[model samples]
Every structure is written in structure tokens, then in C-alpha cells.
Target: MWLDKESQIDLLAYSPFAELITNITANERLNPLTIGLFGRWGAGKSTLLKLVEKNIEERDETKKKFVCISLNSWVFEGYDDAKSAIMESLLRTLMDNQPAFEELKDEIRSLIGRINFMKLGATAIKHGMPLVMSAINPATATLTMAQYFSKTKRKEILNDIKQVWNEKEIEEDRDTTVENIRLFRKEFSDLIDKSEIDNLIVMIDDLDRCTPERVIETLEAVKLFLSVPKTTFIIAVDNQVMKYSIENKYPKITEGSEDFSDSYIEKIIQLPISIPELSETDIKNYLLLLICELYLSKGVPSIKANQLDILLSKVKEDNIFVNGIKIDLEFVKSAFEQYDYTILDKGEIDEFEKMFDIIGKTSDVIASILKGNPRQAKRFLNSFLIRKSLAEIYYKTDRTFDYAILAKLMALEYIDMNRFKELYKWAIENQKNSKIKELETITNISRNDEELPEEYRKWSDEKLARWLKSDPIDLHEKDLLKYFYLTRESLDINVSVSDSLGKAELMVFNKILQSKRATEYSLLIEKLKENKDIKYTKILDALIEEFKKNSKLLKKMQPLYICYSEYRSEIKDVLKKMKITEINLQTATALCSMYQADKPGFSDVIKSWTDKGLAQDVLDVIIQEK
Candidate 1:
């Protein structure tokens, strides 16, 4: 199927990668630069590299010649083999386009020979083959060459090369092989240097799939063997893998040593791009567009643009992370819907729910795992689609949409169940009333809807609690608080007086008060004061209320309070002027008692007020009692 082009949702969309590419391409620098594209496994580093390559190729006709060589080091057995494969791949590309590369043919061929012959004699000896025998017979040599370079033989050759090529040998070949390699790299580099090509960007992908030793070797080859001028290598790799690779490849490079701190490899790289989580809008948009294209391609006339938008919008609103890096949940949902096997008639809200169920569960489960990284989100969704497709074919039914199968798929994705449990607990226990409200909406949709099966619907708080009690996962306090607040918001639940007494509630309340948009602070404080269960002294609550009401005035009158130490006495006078009674004090005290505090005067006032009748005289006595 032909893929439709849309806005690239990758590193290039991020400001740093975009600017780095633009700067490198526009600059006149002759020195080659290396950049490490780092993120966890499943991050879209390969996609980003492809985008860069596309941009480079589009500009090739006008500016410089650009070639993108993507080598998966994991495909090879060792570093030397990977390097040879990478070199061979580049040479083959040039050789294939020999008409265009005629001028650089000799240089390319010479570089290839240097790489091929670097350890020829040693490899021959190690393989227990006569070195001169194959060298003498051209016809037999060609057949032998093919046999010797077979996959298994290639590994042997590479191992033999590494064993024989010591530091001295590397130093000896430094002038011829290294120079030619540099020149070979320069063929592409010089094109960028002379022409309008923005960059000669080589993307190294799938490094994480390689053995640690092979990974290190590949990196060392890039740094030491292929360090050339006027080029840029964007490596798609894992951060931890890169670290291990560097340390293993160059052991002498320690943390504190001058050379250690600024390793040669590290120095060549100007930008180290760490792919962050995608924003919710971006993710949704990407999914929505992808789904639209897929449906149109499949000749599905039922899916309308507006309907798609509505479905996507709802998913985005419900499934999104509030504060963390957001990606459009709607887009992801749309993708699942379009690619889903069971295609219902258009405008079928039930079908929509079914698709949403799949998307929501997948998103929630994967989100719990990757915490909403767009790349990971896409990876998880794509994998689910594949598995579901296979299941549909195998089962001869739409059991692919089953929640149990979905859960199994999620489990297979390596989603850390422990992490999910911890996050869920934190969400439940620490979520604000507002956040709870939002989560409740999702729960309601999941529960009240007929589309979700009864079994899945039965997975409620009690079940969650049981699961937690059994597993005993530790919930991060901050995450718990955030979840609690958000949950409350989602549920539209008011923070009760009882809730205000809880440590978690108090922490969140204070945090909200200190927030930038604290217009509700006074209202919140008033509610807290009114809550009988809040047992803190009323004086403190009253003082806080007064502070909220006259915060600006208090700031202005701070000097007045300092100048007149007796100014505090006016509080009682003001109460007297307002005709506030001992009964009022008793009421405040009773409310405060709900917090379990003992206040003698408040108790005495309450007892007296109770004994006195509700006549004017009693009212007057009550007023004057204090």
C-alpha cells in the first residue's frame, strides 16, 4: 500500500533536532560531526533518521550529493564484520551508480581494497588456507572468494582480522587504510562540502540488537576507523548500550582522566538527541491522519472526516497525560480503529466504542509501561494490530477484540506489571478530586458501556486493591498525589472537610494554593474552614482566611503592624464591634472539635449557650459572655 505523507512526528519536529540539522547543513564547517540519537528501545530514532535522509535527498539535485547508509550492526556477528558490511554497503551503492560516481571510482575502489586487504595475510593463516594458492588462480579465486565470504566464513575472517590487527598494525595502516577510509568517507562529505547538500548524514540503526561486544566494536569503528571531515553520523541507539559500548571499547578512558572525561568519540558528536515523550495533540493528530489514509486506501466509504475527528477528540481528552509530555491520544485511537479487523458500518457508535475499547486498553496498558511516549505508543499499537490480525485469521472469529487477548498482548509487550500496579495505586490514592473525576470518566465509559465485556468491567477498585495487597508495590508519593488530584478533578468531587484533614489532601491543597492561578485559594480555604472534620485551631484557619481576603492590604499594613505592636489587640475589639457572640465562638470550637482537638473555652461557651434559653436576654448574655 502506498503511504500518504503527513507531518513528520519525530525528532525533527522537536526544536533541538530540527535546529541542529539546519545549522549543520547551512554551516561551512569542514569537520565531520557525530550525533547520538538516544532513547529507550522502541523510541522512533530510525524514523527520525529516515526523515533527515529524505530531506537530504530532496535537496540533492540543487545542492550537494547526499547518501544515507543505514547499517544494522546486530545483523553481523562482531564489530569488524559490521564495519566491513557497512563499508561494503556504501561501496556497492556507489558501484551501482557508477555512471554518476565515475570521477570517484578509483578512490572508492582503492578504499574498498584497503578495507578488504587490511588483514588478508592473517585471515588466510587463521582459516588454515594457502594464501598464495587463491591469490594465483583468478577463476578458482572468485569461487573461493565467494565461499570464504559466506556468512560463517565472514565471521571467521572478521575474528581473524581482529586477532592479527594490533594497535601497531592499526597505526601502520593509519596512513593508507585510515586515509583511504577518510577519503572514501570524504567522497560523500566533499559533495556536501562543495554542493548545496545540507549534510552527508549516515544513520546507524538497530545497535541495541547487537551483542554488547559487537555494539562496542561498531561504535569504536565509527569513532576511530571512520572519523572523517565534513560529515555527520546520526546513531540510533540506546543510552545504556552506548555507555557500555564506549566503556568496553575504550577501557582506558576513565571518568576523571582528562582524556577520559573528553573521550575522542564523545568529542566528535556535537548533538546528543534524547527523544522525549510526544505531546498528546501530536500523537492524536498522527493517528487520526494515519487512520484516515488507511481507511481511504481500503475503500471504506463509511468513515467521515468529522466522525473520525470526534472519535479522536474524545480519546485525546480522556486518555491524555495532563502535565507530562503529551501525545494526541485521539490519533492513536483513530489508528487502531482504521486498522482494526472488524469494520462496522459507518456512524456505528457501537463500533466506535469497540474500537475505542481496544485503543483505550492498549493505550492505558502501554501508557502504564512507556508512560505515553509517542514512539512506544505507536510501537505498542502496531504490535497489537499485527497480533490481532493473526488471531482473527487463526481463530476464524473476531476474538482478537477480546479483552483477555488484549491483556495477554499487553503482557507480551513487556509492560512492567509491577510498574503498572504502582502507577495505578498512586493514581488512586494520590489523585486530586479533579484528576479522580477524569479517571472516573474513563472508568464510567469502561463500566457503563456494553461494548466492554463483563469480565473486564469487573476489574474495579476492589480488584485493584486485592492485586496491590497481594503484590505490595510501592507507590511514589508524588505520583500518588498527582493522580489523586487529577482523579478528583475528573470526578468533579469537592474536597470534603474529612479529606482536608488527610496528610495527602493537605499537601495537595497547599500546593494548589501556591500555584500560579490561585484565584480559588480563598474558596478552598473557606471550604476547609467550614469542614467540621478539619480539627486545626479556628484561629489559624481564620487568620489564613483573613490573609486571603486582604492579602494585598496585609502587605500594605505589614509596616503598620510592626510600627504598632498593640495593633493585634484590635482583633478582639473588631470582634466586639461586629457583635460576634460566645455562641459563635462555641460553634467554631465545635466545628474544630471534629478534628479531635480539645478547647476548654469553646467547650464552656457551648455548655453555657445550651443551658441558656433562646430569649433576647440569653442572646445578649451570650454575646457579652466572652
Candidate 2:
């Protein structure tokens, strides 16, 4: 299996992002810079950061060489304080990079030892942190102190901190903590000068993946390093997640205050860079290259790997993101003469060449529905290849497979799962009908023919009709065939995780089910209309039980009046339990307004309510709706 991780070199084309980093790193400035690479998860932010690091290394010989340190804050997030994780990680990395600054390291370690890790929550909530002190953590500081000094010396240091706490001159331990942090920063700058490094570039990644507390703690820790000269910090994060983390961390911002999270992030991330989503062309190129790489690794001899690499380099350099490039067989043969492609028979060469040709034929169809996401495109290919392999193994035959229909069906399944479910249902229903002319059409010939729900109606004619005629090769075993094998844990293709309601949606529906306030009625009515596909009984049963438990809610059931048609009999049962005279007349008004013109017996229903002893106010509402 291919590893989905960042490498130090040889990633996809990121010329635009690399150029921006190159420009920023090469310029001279007096103060430190905090640059951010913002994009969604799997949008290639981490890979781009690695490429930028490669670029810096390659170009450093002509300019200043940077001491680059890579720090993933999430790795140590198991600890109590996120700030301490960053501080300890940064210190260890700096020490590893510049072993010559032993004396300065000792002083920094001593200052770190002064911090009380348990007291950080109060400090962070009150004033955040001071530059040098903010990076201090109790766990790491204690560990580092033990490493550098004796047990007796460590106790003395602890005693001094306790004495300072008792003095009360510093009202909060925060003041002393800030002083120790400041001293460490001064010593750190001296260490940098002594090491003769041009600058320190710290690459911080995976920060957005941390918890809300960790995210806020990491951001606060980073602020301490911003004032240090000749330092650059590159942070990778998703903006959406960071915004949510900020809100979660500080839930009670002042009512009229500005957006606190955005304001704080703006102040910290000086130069923010975003990675754009993949384009259609980019996805096609990525898919083609990935498949070719797999083929070269598996089928071809080791020597051909070099040939394929050369071809890939040229293709990327020429900016051919599509798969329709003309092949020069003569040029390829000449180039591979040293490797032995020249010695192969023409038949073998032709077979090898077909691998490249197949990509061009299928790229257009695959790219159209993959939505320009490289990861999803890769997943589709993995699924297709796996299913193809399984079929070959199970049948024990050398028969050729036609992947065209499977590819189209897979696209439908990935893009819109519910549509695919309906298509699959229709395909199975007509699996035995082989005659193309006799196949059922989506256009109903008569009103008596069963009509699909509106959700399935829109996709039936275009996506489903074509498949009914030319179905998958395994139509005889269509009932057992696994079309959605790649995405699902089981072989069941008729259902999927996407078909279920999400957590937020379930919460909204449950709130509507038990709500008692009259003002919530409008929103409840809208929610019912929006979620019409969900079983109406699922909602009605919940409301019916809630009303049975709390009779007062029966009066505020006016909003549910719009949805009575789905549960007419059950609603009548609920109404019988309560006197019609006690019912809210506004509900009758709403019902008449909605159905008086279209419904046949709607006027009689209104007159029946009055005959059953509805109030004068209720009669007036019925007259107006009439």
C-alpha cells in the first residue's frame, strides 16, 4: 500500500507556494515573522510545507543557510499544557541543531525549571503568557532540570520558586514566570549568535488537529517567540477548524465585542498563505501519475523505474496535466537502450505502451465527477483496482475486464449515494430482462405506473436509464455483486453512511420533537418541511409520546398542523383524547388557509370543528380562511 505522508523531497508540483516562501525567506527584516499556511485537511498544506523546506535547502548555498526545525505539536498533546509541549519541543530541537551552545542551554533550562505547570490554567485564562515564560511547561521543565543538575540542586531550585511564591511581592506567580521567560529569550538569542546560523526557521504542523484547548494553548505559546529577532515560524492549520477551536476555547466573549477569535489569529499570523483546492486538470494528472507509478513498481523491472521517472519529470516540467500527451516510441527506445528496453520484442513494448494509453481514455470520465479532490480520486482508483483484482481471483479466468461501466457507476456512487441506491434498485429489478427495447424507461407511460419519490425522480432518467440497458458484466449475480465495496465496510450496496442523518441534524429534529415554547413553532414547521424524506412516523411518534406525557404541549401544537396530512389518523386519535373546544383555534385557521382551496372536504372539516363546540374565536378564524 502507498503511504499517505509527506516526504522531504519529490512531492507534486507546488511552484506557486514554493515561490512565495522563497521570496519571504530571502528578504531581510529586523523582527521575527510568523507566516501561516492555511488550507483544509488533505488539501496538501503539510506536503507544501515540506516542499518549501526543500526549496530553502537547495537555494541556501547562494544565500544564508537557515537552521530549520520541524515541530508537530499534536505529538505531545497527551500532556497537560499545550504551551509546555511546544516549549519543550522547541528547546530540544534547538539543542539538537546547535550542540555547541551548551552553556546557554543550561541557563535556558534553569529558567524553564522555575515555572509551576499546575498554575498555568489560571495564568493562561488571566493574561495568556509572557514571551519567554509562555513557552515554559511544568512537565518538561522538571524533566530537563533533572537531566542537567543533581537531585539536591533541583530541590534548591524548587525551594527558591516556593520562597518567591510565599513573598507575596509578586501578587501572582505570573510576574515571576514572565521574568524567567524573558531571561530565557535573551539567552536563546545569544545562543543563536554563538552558533553562527543565519536564522532559525521553525516549521510547526498538525496544530489544527489538536483539541480546542490545545489549539488555543499552542497559539499562545507561539506568540512568545514572535519578538525574537532572526526567527521565522511557519504554522500549518485549517482556518475553519481554528475558528471553531477559538470559539470553543472562549465561549463567553463580551456581547458587543468584535469576533475575538479572528482578531486574535490576525494578530498572531502575520503573513497568511492558503493552498487552493485541486483543479480538474490537477486531479487528472495526479491520478495518472499515481497509477503509472503503481504499474512501474509492480510489473516492470527495477531498471524501468528510472525510465518512468525521467518521463514523469519531463511531463511535469512541460506542464502536461492531462493524459493525452503524444508518445515518441523511437525517442523512448533510444533513451532506454542503456536499460534494455531496446532489447525487448515489439509485442512486449506495445503491451507496456498500452498502460499509458488507457489513462488518457479514462481520465476525462474520472475527473468530471471526482470534484478535484486528489485523495478522493486516489480512493476511487484503489476501489476499482481492488474490485478488478477480486473478480479475476474469484473467477479463475483470464477473461478481459471492461472497466468503463464500472467507472461510471462508481462516479455516481461517490458523487450522490442516494441516487446510486435508486439506480441499483432499478438495475436489480430488471436484471433478468436482457432485451434493451423491453427495458423499463424512467418516463412513466401511465399515471397508474408507480412513480419514484421526487428525490429519485430527477436522477432516474439520465443516470439510471442508460445503465438499465447495458448493465454490469455480472448481471446474473447482480444481487450478490458489491458495487459500493470500496466505500463500505460490508458488501451491501443499497445503503451507505451518507444515507443517515448527521449528529447536528438529529439534534435539531430531537429539539423540535420535545419543544414546548410557542415561538419555536415556526422553526419547527420549517424543519419538518426540510426533512420530509425522514419517516414521518419517526417524528409523529416522538411528538405524540411527548404530548401524552405533558398535556400542556397539546395547546402549542399549532406548528405541527402543517404536517398533519402524513399522520391524519394518528393526529385524529391524539385530538380525540383532548376536547376539541380546548384546542387552539389558530391551528384550525392555519389548516384552512393551507387546504381550503385545494382540499375537497376542507370546508366540511372546518364546519365539523364548530359543530363539535369550537369557541366563537375559532369559528371566526374558519370563516376568514374560507
Which candidate number has the best lDDT? 2
Model 1 per-residue lDDT tens digits across residues 330-422: 444454445443332343445445445445433433344454355555555565556555555655553223433343334322443322443
- Ten residues in sequence with the least summed lDDT for candidate 1: 469-478
lDDT (Cα, tens digit) per residue for candidate 2, span 1-626: 24566644332566667778866876667237888888877667777788877777776643234666778877967877667667767776665454434446665565355334435444433333332222434433332443445666545454555553342343222344555456556766765676666677788899887888788777777775334777788889999988999878656457786676776688678899887776767776666666545544222565534445565566656555434443343434443436343433333545545543455445554566666565566677777667656655654453444444445566556555554554555655665665221123333321224554422344344334333333343333333234443335432653423235456545655677566665685576546646754643334445655665555665445455454543443344555555675557646554455444335534455556667877877666655644
lDDT of 1: 0.45
State, as a TM-score between 0 and 1, how close model 1 is to the true structure.
Answer: 0.46
User: Model 2 clash pairs?
Assistant: 132-181, 133-181
Model 2 residue 122 CA deviation in Å: 9.6
lDDT of 2 at 459: 36
What TM-score, computed on C-alpha atoms, does each candidate reach? Answer: 0.46, 0.65
Question: What is candidate 2's CA lDDT for residue 219?
Answer: 78
**lDDT against the true structure, each candidate:** 0.45, 0.57
Candidate 2 lands at a TM-score of 0.65
